[model samples]
Every structure is written in C-alpha cells, then in structure tokens.
Target: MLYIQEMHEGMKVAGIYLCKSRTAAVTKNGKNYDNVILMDKTGTIDAKIWEPDSAGIEEFDALEYVDVVGDVTKYNGNLQMSLKRARKAREGEYDPKEYLPTSDKNTEDMYKALLTFVDKVENPYLHKLLEKYFREDAAFAYRFKTASAAKTVHHSFIGGLLQHTLYVTNLCYYFTKYYPILNRDLLLTAAICHDIGKTVEISAFPENDYTDDGQLLGHIMIGAEMIHDTAKEIPGFPKKLESDLKHCILAHHGEYEFGSPKKPALAEALALNLADNADARLEFITELFKANMQKPDSEWFGFNRLLESNFRKTGDLNAL
Candidate 1:
C-alpha cells in the first residue's frame, strides 16, 4: 500500500483510501469540480476531481472507502491529488484499520505511565478524585485510552489522547521538581484530567471528528463538569479543592482568546497552562517536519499558521 506520507509530486498512486470528506464546487471559470480529502493510516491529503462527469468516475460519499487512481501534484507547498478515476470499494477490498491514523506508541504503555502520575498524588481528596475516573471507572478508562486529543491539531491519531496526557503530565511533574513552589499534586491532577473530556469531545477512530457534545460544550467545559460531578459522589470531598481543580481545567487554555473560559489564576493553574501550550506547539511542529521529511534538510518547509513562521530542518550534525 502507498501510504499518504510516502506520496510525492509526480507519483502515480492507486490504492483504497477512506474518503474523509467530499464536496461539490464550481470553479471561477464556471467549471464544476469535486473537492475531496482522502486518508490512510499515514495521514490525509487533499484531492480534486476535475472531471466529475467522466464515465470512469464512480459514485461515493464521505466516510466511504474508495479505490483511487491519481497523479500527485504540489500546490501551495503541500502535496495533493489530481484524480484520474475513483470508485467505491467492495466489502472484501479493504481493511478499515488501514485507513485510520494511529500513534506509534503502545496504548497500554501510555495508560500505565499516566497511572504513575495518578499514584503520586498525595493529597487524599485529589487522589480519590483521580481514582474515580481513571482507576475505578472501567468504561471511562477504555474510552480515554482509545480517544484522540483533537480532530486535527497535534495528536490526532488513535491513542493520541493518552499519549498527549502522559506528555503533559510528565512536563508538569518536572516543573514541580525544578520549582518546588508549584503544587505537585494539584498540577499533576490537573494535567491528567485536563483533556479527559476529549473521550467524548471527539468520536472514536474512523469517525474521529467533533461530537454534538463537543461542538456544544467543548472539552474544557465538559471536563470541568465531569470532575465536578464525580467529586460530588465522593464522601466529604473538600469544596475548595474541587473548585481549585475545576479552575485549573477551565483556565488551562491560559487566555480568553485561546478558548480558556477563565484565565490562569492559581499558581498551579499557571504552570499547567504553560506546560500544556508548550507540549502542544512543539508536537505540532514535529509532525509538520515529519510530513515533509522527504524534502532537502535545508529546504524551507513552508509558513506555519500555528507557529506563525516558516520552518526548515537544521543541518545534519554529522556534517559538522
């Protein structure tokens, strides 16, 4: 199979890929075309059907599998497909798993690492709260382990949520070590629970897009509500601790412009906000580099809206 990542300009590709989305549009010249997004485990690529009425073109819709024959082309520094033909694949033609992108890391290993942080929470109330969702709830544990952190940004593959949670937790753990002024227990708890709502925010793989709840409530608000409702079940859970934890979740985005319902107020909340932002931005840049790995090491990658800059690979150390 030709993975999307392995595709390059001028290559001819023929394989079955999931149709992530499709749309009909009219060119400025009044010609009609179909814009499509195709996906395989490696990543997604934009595709265009310039002659939609061509006899060989088969009918298909978004979320269906289709066999495509196309020429790769570069547009605006990104690889895209200029389609020659496409047809819906038959039942025995493809495996669904091949079309979903997944984390290279083992999901179980990521979950275990997250638990180590959970075990370190010394505060009794915080510890119990963590235990309720992560330890005691089996269904939630499975969902959390399998969920993606987002539909597109940073970690968007299967097991991505757990991988991202562990990274943020590790970062928060180190922050507490280097700066003892921060509350280790509070910050770590916030880190693990920060994106927990993502389990519901985005649907599972193959349909890893926003849920109705995700659109209406978002992960931040949903996560805060999850923590609050769970804490209410614990006997004699401290009201102030619950409030502080929710505050951490609500304010973790750091600013109103960034979707943070409340800006970081507590010292621990501030630490978590910084850790979360740094991890997300760094991971995004790393993925951008990987997608363009075939380009010359010194070649400029392209302008990145997220980082607000163009990027290029540093020279190889061996050359030095």
Candidate 2:
C-alpha cells in the first residue's frame, strides 16, 4: 500500500484509502469540484476531484474507504492529489487497520510505564484517585490507551493520549527531582490526569474528530469536571487537595488566550503547565520534521502558525 507519507509530487496514486472527509465546492471560474482528504495509517493528504460528475467518479462519502486513482501535485509547497477516478471500496478489499494512524510505541508497555508513575504518588488520597482511573477502571483504561491526544496537532495517532501522558509525567518527575519545593505527588498526579478528558474529547479513529462536548467544553473543562466528580466519590477526600488538583488541570494551558480556564495559581499547577506545553510543542516539531523528510535538510519549510516562525531541520553536523 502507498501510504500518504510516502507519496511525492509527480507520483501516480492508485490505492485504497479512507476518505477522511469530502466537501463539494465551486471554483471561481464557476466550475464545480469536490475537496477530499484521504487517509492511511501514515498520515492524510488533501485531494480534489476536478470532475466529480465524471463517469469515473462513483458515489462515496466521508469515512468510507475508497479505491482512488490520482496524480500527486504540489500546491503552495504542499502535496495534493488530483483525482481521476474513485469508487467505494468493498469490505474485503481494504483492511481497516491500515487506514488509522497509530503510535509507534507499544500501547501495553506505555500503559505499564504510566502505572509506574501512579505507583510513585505517595499521597494517600492522590494515590487512590489515580488508582480509581488508571488501575481499576477497565473501560476508561481502554479508551485512554487507544485515544488520540488531538485531532491534528501533535500525537494524533492511536495510543497518543497514553504516550503524551507518560512523557509529561516523566518530565514532571524530573522537575520534582531538581526542585524539591514542588510537591512530587501532586505534580505527578496532575500530569497523569492532565489530559484524561481527551479520552472523550476526541473520538476514536478512523474518525478522530472532536466530539460535540470537545467542540463545546474542550478537554480542559471536561478533565476538570472529571477530576471533581471522581474526588466526590472518594470518601473523606480533602476539599483543598481536590481543589488543588482541579486547579492544576484547569490551568495547565498557562493562559486564557490558550483556552486555559484559569492560570496557574499553585506551584504544582505551574510545573504541570510547563511540562505539558514543552511536550506538546516539542512533539509538534518532531512530527513536522518527519513529514518533511523528503525535502533538503537545510531548506526552511516555511512559517508554521503553531510554531509562529519559519522552521526546518538542522542538517547533521557530523557529516560536515
């Protein structure tokens, strides 16, 4: 199978891919066209059917797997496809697994590593809270392990939420080591639970789009609510401790402009914010580099909205 990531300009594409989305539109010249996004485990590509009514084009909709024949072309420095033909793929013709992006790491191993952090929480209340979600809840554990962290940004593959959580937790653990004033249990617990809301925020693939709740309330708000409700169920859970933990989750984004409902008000909240932002931004850059591997190492990719600047690979210095 020709994965989206392996495609290049001037290549002929003829394969079965999941039609992530499709939209009808009219060109400025009054010609009609269909905008489509095709997906496989590697990634997604923007495609267009210039002649949607052509005999070669058959009925197909978003989220359906289709056999597509197209020519890869570059537009605005990005790869796109001009489709010649497309038809809904039969069930036996395509494997569903190939169409979903997944983390390179093993989900089971990552889940175990996450539990290790849960074990590290020394505060009795925090430990029980962590245990309730991480160790005891089988259904939630399955969703959390398989869910993506975001719709399109960093860590958008299966097992992404778990992988991002573990990375943030590890970073917070290191911060506690250097800054003894930070509450290790509080920070670590916040790190693990920080993105738990994401389990419901984004639906499981092959349609990893935002849920209605995700669009309305977002993961930050949902996560804070989750923490609050869970703590209420635990007997004698300290009110101050519950408030502190929710504060960390609510303020992890660090600013209102970034969608944080509250800014960091506690030492642990501040640490969680730094750790979450660092992991997310670094992973964004990492995925950017991977997607642009075909380009020359020294060539600047261009200005990225998320990075807020032009970016590119620093070519290997050892070869110099």
Candidate 3:
C-alpha cells in the first residue's frame, strides 16, 4: 500500500481507496478524461482517469470504495494520480474507518477542556445558553465530538470540531487576558457555540458533503438562529445579550466578501473572528505544505490565494 504522502513522480500505487468524487470532461482537442478525487486515511489527491473507457474501469460513484492502480505524477507541485485500472472494492476489501482522517488530539481531552470554559463563564444567561448545547444536550454533544469543522477546510476530519473549538476557545481565553476591555464571558461563550450549526450543515462521515440547510442558510445563519432559539428557552436571558451573541456568530466570518452577514460590531465579535480566521488559515497552509513536501527545492506552489504567497520551500542551498 502506497501512502499518498510518499507518492513521487512515475511511482506505481495499488490500494483500495474511497472515490470521493468523479467528474467526466473533455480536453480542448475533444480528448475525454475523468477528473477524480481519491481519498485514503492520510488525505485526498486529485487523480486523472485518462482511460475512463478502458476495459478495467469500474462502475462506481463517490463514497464507494475501489481498488485502484495508477501512476503518481506531480502536477503543479501536488501529487496527482493517473489511473490505469480501477474496480469497485468488494466486501472485506477495505475498512471504512481507514479511509477517513481524524484529529490527532484526544476527543475526550478536548471536550473536557471546553467544559472548563463553560464552567468559568460568569454571565448566567450566556452560561445557560451554552449549557443547553454543550453540556445538557446529549445528542449535540455526541455529534460535536465526532463532526468536522468544514467538509473541506481546516479541521475537516473526525474530532476536528472538538479540536478546533478547543483552539478557538483557548485563543479567546488569552485575548480576554490581554485586552481587559474584551468581554471574557461573552467571547468565551460565543467561541464554544459559534460553529454549532455545522453539526447540521454537513452530513456525517463517508458522505461529508453539504446538506440542504448547509447550502441554503450556511453555518453562520443557522448558528445565529440556533442561538436565538436557545436564548428564548432560558429564563431572563437578556435580549441585547442574545443579539450580541448572534452578531458574533454572524460576523465571525469577519468580512463582507467572506460571507459575514455583519462586520464585527462588538469588540468580542472581532476577537472571535480573528481567532477563527487564524486557526482556519494556519491549518490550510499546514496541509498545503504537507502535500507539497515531496519537492524540497520547488518554485511557486501554483496559485495559493489563501496564503497570498507561494512561499517556496527550497532544498538545502546551504548544503552546497
């Protein structure tokens, strides 16, 4: 079995992988090919099925497992597979869990750390609102521990939501410490609950695609509505506090172009936005470099709009 990270140009790979997606297309000269996404436990890679009509091609769809034989090639510094043969995997051929990546952090440890923040929240109404989702709600707790932060972004794996929430919550803790003006209770509570709607936004594993609500309202809107509903259930939850909390969730996206419904009107909202953006962008860059590590002396990493610079990871120029 060839781990995707170890693949190099012209290397042969044979393994059972999940067919994340498959798209048929034609080149400018009318040559047909298939653009596919293949996934194993490590990560996903872009694969081209040049011989889609070949005799060995399998009848399969995204989410199905298949045994694939391919030549590894580097495309713009990222590994891409050129499939020579593929067939739907039979029962006992592969374990589904092996095809899904999970956070290295312990889920239980992450959840318990989050609970400490919930305990320290001073505002009664905000505390209770967070409790409704994080502490008392058994089902939401179960899903949150298992859910991914995004279907394909930072923290998009099992235990990812918990890992990301822990990081953002920790960020808020330090933010409140540094800036005495920031609302510790409001920021911490908002941190824990900001992405709660993502539980419903994306489907559970093996098919972690967008749901109907995820596509229509998105996590930001759905999360705001969720907080509003929960705030109503709590007795004497201040209306203004409820509004501010929702503002944090809505404005957490930070900028209008990034889909934030509102800019960070409150200082606490701004803090949460920065924390969220930092975690997401850092994780994305880390994953990008991991995928491109095969080429040490590489030039530009193509067009990575997120990092803004294709920071070249050059080989040991110091060696010579």
Please, what is the whole-model Cα lDDT of each candidate in the order they appear?
Answer: 0.91, 0.93, 0.87
- Give the poorly placed runs of model 3, Cα more than 4 Å off: 23-33, 74-78, 292-303, 312-320
**Sort by TM-score, top down from the best:** 2, 1, 3
- Considering summed lDDT, which 10 consecutive residues are worst modelled in model 2? 311-320
Clashing pairs in 3: none
**Candidate with best TM-score:** 2
Task: Name model 2 segments beyond 4 Å from true.
Answer: 28-31, 296-299, 315-320
lDDT of 3: 0.87
Task: Please write out the lDDT profile of model 1 over residues 1-320, one tens digit for every residue.
Answer: 88998898999999999999999999999999999999998899999999999987999999999999999999987899999999999998998889888888999988998999999999988999999999899999999988888899789998888988999999999999999889889999999999998998899878799999999999999999999998999899999999999999999999999999999999999999998998898878778877766665557887888788998777542332
Better of 2 and 3 by lDDT: 2
TM-score of each: 0.92, 0.93, 0.89
Please, what are the lDDT tens digits per residue for candidate 3 over residues 106-187?
Answer: 8999899999999999898998887888889999999999999998868888988888888999999999999999999999
Extract clashing residue pairs from model 2.
none
Query: Of the candidates numbered 1 and 3, which has the greater TM-score value?
Result: 1
Q: Give the TM-score of candidate 3.
A: 0.89
In candidate 2, what are the lDDT values of residues 280-316, reduced to their tens digit? Answer: 9998988887776766645787889878999856864
Residue pairs clashing, model 1: none
| Native-structure RMSD, model 1 | 2.6
